[model samples]
Target chain A: MKTRVETVAIIGLGLIGGSLAKALKDNGFCREVIGYGHREPSLRRGLELGVIDSFTLDLDAALSAADIVVICTPTLVAAEILVDILARTEALEQPPVITDGASVKGNLERAARSACKEFPPYLVLGHPIAGSERSGVEAARSDLYVNHRVILTPVAENSSEALALVSDMWAAAGATVVQMTVARHDAVLAATSHLPHVLAYALVDALAESDESDEIFRCAAGGFRDFTRIASSDPVMWRDIAIANKAALLQAIDQFNEHLQQLRRAVVEEDAAGMHETFTRAKQARDEFAAILAEREQAKTS
Target chain B: MKTRVETVAIIGLGLIGGSLAKALKDNGFCREVIGYGHREPSLRRGLELGVIDSFTLDLDAALSAADIVVICTPTLVAAEILVDILARTEALEQPPVITDGASVKGNLERAARSACKEFPPYLVLGHPIAGSERSGVEAARSDLYVNHRVILTPVAENSSEALALVSDMWAAAGATVVQMTVARHDAVLAATSHLPHVLAYALVDALAESDESDEIFRCAAGGFRDFTRIASSDPVMWRDIAIANKAALLQAIDQFNEHLQQLRRAVVEEDAAGMHETFTRAKQARDEFAAILAEREQAKTS
Candidate 1:
């Protein structure tokens, strides 16, 4: 049987939390979806859009009512909030299960570790591998996580019941649940998502500061625009992520720099063979990745 | 009035040449479209697909019957072919107006200058800023250049007749013809197109060579796919571009390296303010670029 919650308290109402609230309510996975945030306009918008049943400024009130609580703030903020949630629910007879939607998992893992000797049973650390460039409650939708992967990095102390409940909620919202170690999650994400964002931001920032900035912007075509799309993502959120996943991101950056040097040497010496081999290897990998995505989509619909 | 040609000889049967052949035929701008290439299968495929009306293995035969000749090959090859075309057509009563679709203009510029005291009046240098990840004659389509910019870099010796004919051909194919100096075109493209391609190729190649490549590959999502889309472009073509646009590209690379160093330092020191400022600037630039695109698209459709 699928697990259901009586109440789900969402600590933030940005895209991830707002979309989850909408998804859970749409699927009837929760009896009441209560939002907790400082922003009044977004909470009111959530209520008007039928994204949440109710909302409060009081974190205690929301946690008191919820059977499950999801912290969905930026990474550093989410880590701090996780600590507060752990402390506030310490004495309760049956405290709410807690999870988060932060991009980086190491900081959350550390926060959870600080509150427990081994690992907190009810603190089910997670990162739903789903989002859009748009943010906040205004952009929330039920199908946001459909056919997407929701990665849950469960600790040793995670209660089976807590894991089941979180998994069922995600499944109800049309997401495929996968498990990973927090360390592995951080490293993989640094290479794939965070690193790409950094390269794009650096490229754009560099070009913007160049002497020929006006001419540079005028000549940017479809490919340049597409490659830099992710650079337009939220700055505060990325800043938080860069800090939260610092070690792994730096490692990825260093690796990329070394390879870039090799490429630069080839270009400088006009090493046609060296450039061809690197490009060929990348093309094969990218093409394979594309095929995998296609197969996964086909599997979902099939 | 639109300029018309009796027979147009495309000296290469790849995407650019094939598409131009298709577009000209589709618009009735030319009486016959003849393809010149060494590959029999591709030339046959071009004929079967109606991308070209006739095929020729002999460059001399193709040049002999043509009112116009487009040397559309990889950059280096295009330069060599330009020299041969100049020599053959040197003794003709009225040499066909020549142009090319090479990405980098310097090589072509040098070739033209070597053959004449000034830029050959009959030779119009051009680069159409339109392409897909797909290439070759089989992937060609008539609408490839529609709504795209075709930049023509005319020299001091370019006759009014040659320049007008080349501009009219591009206009007939649904491209907006723009003019720039050879140096400006190379620099602008190095910053906008070549730099981004190098970064994407480097990122992908670097990740593919990492220890956790399997796990990293598994976690790559839509944004990674979109950012790396251009890395799948033909390696040989890019290699030629890298060598052909060497000086400008190296200058762009050196500039980018400095900015990347600043970003790396910010990340290493955990300078939240620095990271945020850079990301915000990039986001603002990206957003404005997006707005400009939307406006241009709106203007086009309206």
Candidate 2:
């Protein structure tokens, strides 16, 4: 089998970046894995951990030798870096296919379009739906993307060859590639990812500032712990996500607020039947989601 | 060491009830374990599973044979059952010391006081801060309460001896007992447990009814699964809990709404600093809560 990507460049050297480099190296998906980051220590650590064969601080040098580039910086920083990379790679005889691991797509796409006049057809927007509460190169793993969904939102300007290269790269990293429009991707992610993160942070912040904070947390058991687990996620990263996907996230917040208000009314009015109806519906939906995920895992293993 | 109680009766052979029976039987907290339930099948299953040495549908018979009775029914049902038990035990020569595993404490305490002219000093209200998303006797485990917190809210009418007996029983079941007022327990639980359940149910319910329901749920990953795991919990049980602790739960919902609103505004206004601060505070608080729980677990093992 001919490899779709010969040499890959990963920017950021964080969890996603380092993990992708390691997965590519372990799977023999590419001939060389080059890591680039503003942090000298993280770049060195990525080399020490065998996440990359070489390290570079210069974006032009990294882009010059790469067949594909995976941007893994935080959302805001990723947008800025993508613009810089597009400008640097424009002069290359064969500019490497570009993609990113950003959680939000709409803002990044707009920023990319505005940064370059031609808005390179090789730029394929992507997000790998896998991460942990922990961050940085130390938390990266070779199997992080295995069996996980990596959504690709390819624009009209994207060439089919570029899309195939980026998709194949993610497949090589052990992720299942799914394609959708940018709007649909942002809306669905807002509901599933961004909304839940906001709710977790808000719930924990509310409880933390309460008068009985000590007792409240002391008595919090498994359910509370799991429910708020995402509250312990990287704050700056989430802050950027919340800002980047502002419109869709705001709409999600409104919808959730409406549902919560209905529940609050039910509780205040002591409407047991209404409360039961809502809770039962939620359980059914949640159970169906779990069943689907289980089936997917079974399919992957079997 | 001598067993604190020679005979124990568990009413409503559901998750908590069956688990308590198993724990008591395993720890030898009592010589005889009696199970009572309105459902004959669960009662029979309790005995067949060795969760109970005997089974009965007769409340009076079970109460008479018990040295201590642990009521583990839905909040509303538990309140009604407690009243019925208090009424029946009034004429007894020596009534069994009473405790309950109801999630909310205030309403149950009020109902107990109102049920009889002289509220029984033997009644000690408690809630074991342990459970699973699954329910019924089939999900019961002997180690369910191991290293878990059991909050006991003893009113002025509760005798110290009765409190000690109930506390010791839970201790024997591998739980650490903590004391608080009924108001405090209800308030703290509203902030920690009930509010989180409501948010989870509401979030799932909203997404389930959306046009992109399938896509939204299909892409939901580990965070969504864990965050909504409690949404799969028994609906009727949570409904009763929400209604039982209406005032405190409503207040919690309101507080959470305010915090959520703050976050929503930050996103809408593109206030990165405000969102970062909120997420950072939540991360710090959640991490501290996790650290405290880990410390408690370590102390138990060490």
Candidate 3:
């Protein structure tokens, strides 16, 4: 399915929202993209860069004129915004369809349920499996979501029309939309994305503040720096994610900590066989991951 | 100072030794380069790939005919080989100047002290700060060490001539030779190299063995895959490094675990400010690291 709209209002215009606006305009998926935010410089920049057709700080004005609204705030704040959006639209004759680009989906779903007293048929929860350590409208590009996966966790309360429209929008943006439960999405993302980030940040902070910081960093190689690359991601954004997806991320950290302890014990005891087995298993899995990625890349090209 | 030799014996015909052999031969720094290892297939591959001029199964013959020897086995095994080489040549009037590419230095120093009661004058502990996740002689390339740093840990007992000779050898292979104490080398490498490897291996192993592994791996993106790329490195080699650098690595792990637990507490308690502060620090450090690397890269190109 492909989607087109008369106008699209993008709330909280950062990298995610700005990119979506640019992509929508470039694909002619919408006649106009209205950027809604308090960041005057970025909003002005978005208008100047042609990423958005107009800019406004008035939420009501942007929402009333739009056929669709995409909330793109940090995860924790996005839930609050979702609640507010649902409440204010309750009296409308035909409310606009609403979707969000939060990394964690459960909080938004909960907020919607709390506000509406039932699942909001007009509201759909989605997460784009795309981002970078960099942020802001200044970094926006239309191709960010090209060939990326967008996971949509549509609940039973979601109207089929709304779900289809959201899916169509992502498809129009050059993304492959997939469906999953909110629980599954959070858990999988915890292990694959959030957990690695937590570990990387911990490693970087630990090494940087150590007594031998100078020598340690001087000897740090390119691979080691790359391993901690995600530590450079937006701090406030990650903080909200950690709080929003608390339980699953904690479980992920606990599981990884256990595995780390096992390896740590092997090192302490000088148990050569134990360490070798763990290392070999990890190597095999990582190698298989590389092969799968290669196959996926080849399929996309060929 | 630049030095040349009639023959150079590399005691382990793997990626490191083979690359050094090829580089030495390509630079015309030595008349003959010999590979000495028990892995017959890899030794044969080295010969066929022109990575080594010739190879011998007889350690005694190789050592006797060479003016220099480079022990390039895994860190743990390298210690035993060093001890054996030292003992076997104790009676020689002028034994070959010996160097090694073991990632850990303290174990070799301890092994040397235990066997000979003092650090041998002809031995210089060195580690080339270069490698890939891939292994074997077939992966060897002559330019692997070009523009890379190779740290040499030379003790007071090391003869100046022996240290100079080893420095010249690394220089001939296009590596920048830097000197530091053995303890500093182990501690710095523990935090920068060994600790990151341990964490990556643990993350990969934990995710692969979990029940949600299928979904986790399916959702894993390019960045996460590259985050664990070091986990695909040679298992036996990492295992040896873990055992050989046990004390320093354990200290590094303990420090990192403390930072991780602090961050975990912040997440569990929904302490946004605490998490934000830690994340901000980590992000700053990582950003600084990236800038440093970029500056170094610009210097290289300019």
Best by TM-score: 2
B-chain TM-score, candidate 2: 0.94
Measured on C-alpha atoms, candidate 3 has an lDDT of 0.87
Model 3 per-residue lDDT at B106:
95
For candidate 3, what TM-score does chain B get against the true chain B? 0.93
TM-scores, in order shown? 0.93, 0.95, 0.93
| Tens digit per residue, CA lDDT, model 3, A113-134 | 7788678788889988888656
Runs in model 2 lying further than 4 Å from the true structure = A1-3, A91-93, A300-302, B1-3, B299-302
Interface RMS deviation of candidate 1: 0.9
Candidate 2 chain A TM-score vs. reference chain A: 0.95
Question: Quick one: best lDDT, which candidate?
Answer: 2
CA lDDT of each candidate? 0.89, 0.91, 0.87
Estimate, for each residue in A124-154, the C-alpha lDDT of model 2 and write its tens digit.
Answer: 9999999876788988899899989999999
Task: Give lDDT tens digits, candidate 1, residues A124-165.
Answer: 988888888678899998988888888899888789999988
RMSD of every prediction: 2.4, 2.0, 2.3
Worst 10 residues of 2 chain A by lDDT: A1-10
Residue A19 lDDT (model 1): 95
TM-score leaderboard ranking: 2, 3, 1
